[model samples]
Target: MTTSTTTPLQRWKTFFADRSSVVSGIITLVVVVLTLISYTGFLQAVERRSGVVFVDSIHRILGPIDVTWPTFVVLYASLILALGVLLTRPEHLFRTLRAYSILVGIRVICMALLPLDPPMTTIPLHDPFVALFTSSEHSTLTKDLFFSGHTATLALLALSMPTRSLRIVFILSTTALATFTVLQHVHYTVDVIVAPMAALLAFVLNRGFAAENQ
Candidate 1:
């Protein structure tokens, strides 16, 4: 009798061949896409409405500095790195997607409940890539506050990383992004401060749901 062993390629093939995995991935993608669409529309409406603007001591200290390009560089670079690592494990990618979708959904709800106006010293963060996809009228949004999406995104990535070293790297990246967002006055101190906690909550909830299903 001859024994056969599965190669890495075969394992990947098996993972893709699984009907459940494929269906789960498709559903996750659809949910994420729909959530993002709703988020964008909600933000546009929020921008049109007037809201309260409170004085933040941290923003007063840091003032407003335009670090838009550097902010996007760090944000997108960390995102690309996280995707590269997560793509190696399809299950991890799915979990991350589910967690992120939940995070964005939470943000949408929070922003709706807490209508915040942009900081007095606000410097608009102009993202070139966002500009490419969005019209000029809606590209530069300033009122999507109460929680910083940039900070939370990096924090979630840090939490989702499988290895300690990567986690540390992403944690530091999260801190840097938080600082950049504050320095640019794109978000308030409270927004950045609350972001990591929100991400942690989302990650924990997603893991708990996964455990229950298992």
Candidate 2:
């Protein structure tokens, strides 16, 4: 009998080369892209969406900061950095993608199930992606407020990343985003609070499925 030990890179290459892994990656990408399109389409019609005006007391006390641009930059920058960390270890790629796909699916369902009017005092979140679909640069999306997608995404990154250090960074990043969203009156307090629980559930479920695949 002959036994061969595969290097980490070799293992990752083999996994990526596998039909199932490739399919998973492709599916994840498709889900992400489609989810974005669907979510944005929903947002574009927020003007007609049925939602009651919500008065967020948290935004009342904190008083929104005029840091929408800075917060947006930080959120996207942290996500990019987290991806860089994961890319350094190719072994983590597929599992992370699988978890992310589930996160997107959950978010889509949540958005459909819950309709929300943005807090009246919203600071006008300046997200470029959201801006692309809006007629005006400062158009505040008063709907699609079931949960905090930004917070959930960071929570997903924190849960899916392989290293403890990466996890901590992502967690702090998630916390920052949660705070920023509330301070900016971009999301209701409950939306930010409940996002991580949903992300964690998706992460756990995806982990079990990946283990079964192995």
Candidate 3:
């Protein structure tokens, strides 16, 4: 037998070139770039506008107590971990990206059509990601809060994972994230509640594209 130096990832990649991961990957890249652009633009546009206030029931019930200890850090960490899992498999990552394009496109529309200020009691989430594109450190990017991106993103990954076990685990993470987002009052009750449906729709539409690509 020949000396085995090739890694397992190389074997997997070699087996699937015929399945058109190359095309899927290219589309995913394009979509990822576009999504980032649109997301940044949306945030900038929203930042320019005055926030419209809504009386959020969850914020009223929870009273924006500023629980930054475990709830805040743990929820943000879960989003990072969910993304890491999605990147573990090429096929899974590509399909999830395709779905994400749909999810993000819908989100952009929702944010544009439903532009509203954060709840008066909304806890500020000075996210590091938002800071990347912000014009100034003094400016707070808090107005782009129509639906919950964190909840929707984790929901998309949960719905689009390749394996049953991975999907189950991802869903659990999504549930945890949804709970924390609600409890933290970072998102309105309706915002987080409606996000998973949007994500599921995105995944359903992208499945057809994924099937055709493979």
Better of 1 and 2 by TM-score: 1
Q: For model 3, what is the error of residue 79's alpha carbon versus the real structure, in angstroms, after optimal superposition?
A: 4.1
> Where does candidate 2 stray beyond 4 Å?
1-12, 132-140, 212-214
Candidates ranked, most accurate by lDDT first:
1, 2, 3
Give per-residue CA lDDT, model 1, range 1-214, as digits (tens). Answer: 1112544455457669998888888999999889877777777787789988999899888868888888988999999999888877677788999999989988988898999998989999987665553557878888889899889989999999978999999999899899999998898899999999999999999999888976
* Candidate of highest lDDT: 1
Model 3: lDDT of residue 72 = 47
At residue 36, candidate 1 shows an lDDT of 77
What's the C-alpha lDDT at position 39 in model 3? Answer: 76
Question: Model 1: how far is 203 from its true place, Å?
Answer: 0.6
How large is the C-alpha RMSD of every model relative to the true structure? 3.6, 3.8, 4.1
Tens-place lDDT digits, model 3, residues 3-42: 1454447645663765555765786798799788877777
**Lowest summed lDDT over 10 consecutive residues: which window, candidate 2?**
1-10
lDDT of 2 at 24: 74
Residues 58-159 of candidate 2: C-alpha lDDT, one tens digit per residue: 777996776687677778888789777666555476667777778767876887777677887776675776677666723556565768878998999888
What Cα-based lDDT does every candidate model obtain?
Answer: 0.86, 0.75, 0.73
At residue 51, give the lDDT of candidate 2.
74
